[model samples]
Target: MFTSRTFKINKICEYLLNAKVKRCYPKHILSNRSVHDVIDVDINGVKLIFPNVWLRDNCQCEQCFHVTAKSRIIDYNNFNVDTKPVKVTKNSNSLQVTWDDGHKSKYGFNWLKLRSFSPKYQKKYNDDIYRSPKIVWHGKDFYEICKKHDYKDIVSSDEALHKWLNDTSVYGVSVIEKTPNSETAIDEIVKTVGFTKRTHYGEKFVVQNVTNTSNVAYLSSSLQIHTDLPYYEYCPGVNMLHFLVQTKGEGGENILSDGHYTAKYIKDNFPEDFKLLTNVQVEWSDVGEEAGNKFYKLYRAPIIEIDSNDEINRINFSIPQRGSHFPGSIEDVVPWYKALKLFFNLNKKFAAKFKTPEGNILVFDNIRLLHGRNKYEDSENNVRKLIGAYIDWDEIYSRLRCVKVKLNLID
Candidate 1:
């Protein structure tokens, strides 16, 4: 049934179809090419371009890379920046390279794709791996979504711990109910996340009216909503306040406002004021002696800090600790004051008033939330006592990532 001429025609047709299939790859996927300083790799239709120096430094050989340590053991001092790839071969799941120095290196397709020097990949990495997304909220609406976790569950279960940290990351606040009233109870809660951050007030501080008060918070007065430690260059990230004893008298209710929500409102309604708050640098200082140690801390920064991405990062506002000296020009004084007044008024309007029950731990992101309390009478019969501590964001987020990994929420 077959002839020589028919067989030759069939072979020609098959060869043509195979060639056409090879050319069918999408144009967006770059072909393998080496430039003067970089190599363009095409992995299953995804384009990944890598620099020559970077690829050489990231060689995956046992001699150049330590498998146990997951670090590069190559000598940087003897590294050749101009190293060239003498040969390159692509497999189904990896790329093989032979360097000019006869060094053989192989890289997994997924690994190279993750480290792609492309804007799209970079943004994907940031969104998926860098940090959790923040949810800006108003007090009135946030109150309904604010769920309290049991103290025992938070300390005992990883699921509860992840939920608390995740909520705090998104909403910037969380509450724990049924906490022990003992002095060391705060320590147990803090140890679950990280170590206690010590300040001039010691590892932890107490908020109660005293005979000789060093801090304004120790006085029996209505405090304005504000962030703590604006004077510190590296302010504490989170604040945990345990209501050990609540006052029987009227007042002493907590006031809370989301600084990010207020900032967004200002940016939308009063753009000029928002710009002033983010651009004008002011001095925040604290002076006096506490716990038999004298210290004066001062830091200069804008009230509203804007990150490189032009997003509100943190709010620094403390009326009691603000410096007397004005740093702006004379003409900028009234406008700055007006802007600050508007900000304070907006904060008050958006504030949530609540009375945290005794034996409850109210935790919040100090950098993102403004907090204060009403004046309460402190007598022998009724005394208001609160134990407070701080934990850095780095520690909290680190624990969160580890918990997520353990729970298989992320790879």
Candidate 2:
């Protein structure tokens, strides 16, 4: 939306009418228009600011003006040299130069209504290379960890699967619809894709029969939003829940929050704690349900991760599942506890719960979305059982962004 905003446009129009090589510097006649002001420069050095859109077509880059591999041909005749020139600068030593775009070529002093040019050794720009992304472990080892599951094909089309992934990755969650019931269906959805069923604490993939529950209180209980565990290695970044049966209750709702948002909010507003979470790796563990044995493990992950371009990219949140603090773990030093409290409070806003039916696969951006449920009344004899699965971070994103590129939908 950056644009020219001056009344000097009429001055440039006058130059276009004359179309002479007399106009070069428009500063004298510009009527105080700023250099940043998009203008029309006449051969007479008169500044007549022009509309912004009119110049987008004047690009000399290969994307707009197809160049040969040699790039030696100078299409000077096609240059729209009649436009008014803005303020001009010179090389620190001798020749008078014009404008500010890193170009050092000496020309006919007619750069009035055009883009500034310098001796560009390179002609193309690649934004992806310049970005400083924080995501690590995208190399061979990570692939080896994922490639182990090994299946012929989870989805029918590579292109189609890529498209479907974006819908789930960008948003906090995605749904797979029209699936029929059975353990076979669950395996078909996740098994071919090679998802590791991450289990820690006591909730990895707990399945219960309505008829077998000894605690009657569980039949009517509501689940709060929590990570699968606060302790465990990797903490399983993908969480999927499939409904086998719909409860007859009138008000049970599912909710989710984006850790990406919570992390970014804190990074920008609470620099200190954001610093803490990224600076140190914490330990997490699960106290076993068994009376005699307990299990524990640890991991190193930042609460927030940004891409090379510095966009809020990913989140690793499952604090409750973390093992015991590591030896020599730095104790909380700052008023960061207050900021941590506030960050989780902010996550409270992303809660979104709704009724789910059989055959729906609710997939979450395990690194980002916090899942929970609302309380509902249920018949004592008929409790509900939920089926679940998992997927990885890299595979899902690769699929989603590929589609976004084709559809021109990525933000």
Candidate 3:
């Protein structure tokens, strides 16, 4: 038989695990004091204090918070900031309070526990902690990891589709094998996640050597490592390349390096370079006129971007697409060059080379993985052709969430 203390502890644990909270009366109270405009209450050896205004504003009743939308409907101007609670008493599984305004508020102990500001519940912010699902990969070992799905399985079975998306989300790259060699095939893959992210290049772009090439990628030349469309304000999230023709080739192997890993390496070894790269903003532009289509896209952004929490969010890097114009202080030119060189060297050192044969599709996070191809000359007898498309992470993330819910992975 469990004691009252043990039962209460078990209940708290259950709430933490599944949010299956059981409302039980407070058994023991060490302290209950009205301090200023707040009420400090101690129960089960845990100290918690509730502010009068905060308690009134956070009432969960239908009158205060809408039951359908679950949003607060209380007028902000109605509550007094310095209002005092006339009485604070413990009710079943809650703290019942009467404010000086004669307004009654009842707060669930479980709800308060969830939003506790106690030293025991507070977690010190750590710079090393990654908030998103940006997993870093390194070395040739990354190539060894092969999470491939059949084209039919992905389209037919939700389980297979979810697994593929999960792998791409977690690893930032995944392969789909035995796909048909057609333009619609790549479109199908994009539709599985979301609609095609139409860009200046249109809906679908062909990756093949052209007679008059506007982009360097169109020609059969060695392309340096880069993420596509760095100049776009909202860069494409995921890139899908479906190889329709990958004949005998000596140097057409794809070169990929995890930008997150490269960033981490620079931060760990060359902290100065990392800081400079993250702080210095550079101009990226795409100027061209091909087949009567004229477009010049340009945007200024830092090589490394950090989120509000100071975690590395995205790496906007494209050497060929970088504009030559220097917008900042002339003194920053030398330092910026040095920092960029160090970063490029680190990326080169960590890059992995792989080849996607015909009937194989490559999908990777455009924001996380920097991709390129080795130089290969055009052959009259053998030709290499690939169709590519883009999809935003918003769609992929939504699909992932839906899949998880369907599988009952989350409540």
Candidate 4:
């Protein structure tokens, strides 16, 4: 019984009364060129601005999106960058749009807010999606908080397994107590979290004094602190070393130092050295025969690797495996050596020296922690034996996510 003008006025009044109106602009009425480029909608005191092109490209219709894959199916070849909405309507919980091409799209208020380009929303999304942050630790302090999970509990209880994985993710090291003294023990423990990563040494390798050893770990001599497999482009992640036979002699203790912690120390005290290590690439190579197969592996990477966020992502330093091929300018030799020496010295200074008990599994992030062993005598009666295996971070993180979901730790 009312005119079109009266109805439009009444609708605006109702919207103003019910909603906390900020800025709701329809594309058709926007004469300002800049305003026409985006669609702004305010819901629940939050304003989300969506570019016209983004909105069209991200259409959630069945034809434009794949529901199961949760991905866009829109063909970019035919996509119009200048596409504009002919009409926009705000409902109770969503914003509805009719495109110029007669394509209809609807976006939930929450979804739009989450995909906002604002820094706050971007940070929130990253925090919610990324893995848990690493907690860097020093020697004595880390040793005090280092968790030891019983092997049986980890195998049987989901809660226990989650706790153990979380501890390893945060602290980069953990111990599994009461692990059976057998080669299969390492297999059992790794299966709980993920599958064993096969390398040139196979799925598992023995660590004991041998007649002709291809690796330094097989020798009874003192091993300087180093991460394993620096020569590989994609190195192994988690390492599980099970003590089957404990050395009865002195100087057989294991040494562990947090590489991330050491890197941070250098960054704070010697920023130039830290920059050099992070920027200069060095060749890490290995040429040997293992398990009856001869191979030569080489990789070049900075001693310290940082991610896009400039956060420490990896530390690759292996003196024995380092190739003599210096690809850098001749002037960088002494400075590079000085930085390398500082890193090695700090690793030794901050290392935790301890003898892992027999039947205990020493699990650690191979990429984050440098591990070594002291000199030991390997006689008939006091022979030291250990079984070592590697698992990738992909499997570990996937397992952690599954456990977290099962435990309702995350959605």
Q: Candidate 1, residues 126-239: lDDT per residue as tens digits?
A: 655567778887878867756688999999999999899888888889999999869889898898898988899889999999877778899778999999999998999999
Judged by lDDT relative to the true structure, which candidate is superior, 2 or 4?
4
Better of 3 and 4 by TM-score: 4
Which residue pairs overlap in candidate 1's backbone?
Answer: none
List candidate 3 stretches off by more than 4 Å. 1-132, 144-146, 290-293
lDDT over C-alpha atoms for residue 208 of model 3:
91
What does candidate 1 score on TM?
Answer: 0.85
Model 2 misplacement above 4 A: 1-160, 191-204, 207-220, 289-294, 300-302, 305-314, 322-334, 378-381, 397-411
lDDT of 2 by residue, 348-371 (tens): 664554666666667776666666
Instruction: Residues 225-343, candidate 3: write the lDDT tens digits.
Output: 99899999999999999998885858799988889899988889989888888888889999988557899999988898888877777889898999998777888889989999888
- Write down the lDDT of every candidate, Cα atoms only: 0.83, 0.48, 0.76, 0.83
TM-score per candidate? 0.85, 0.51, 0.77, 0.84
Least well predicted 10-residue stretch by lDDT in candidate 1: 1-10
Better of 1 and 2 by TM-score: 1
lDDT of 1 at 79: 91
Q: Pick the candidate with the highest TM-score.
A: 1
The best-first sequence of candidates by lDDT reads 1, 4, 3, 2
Model 3 residue 173 CA deviation (Å) reads 1.0
Model 3 clashing-pair count: 0
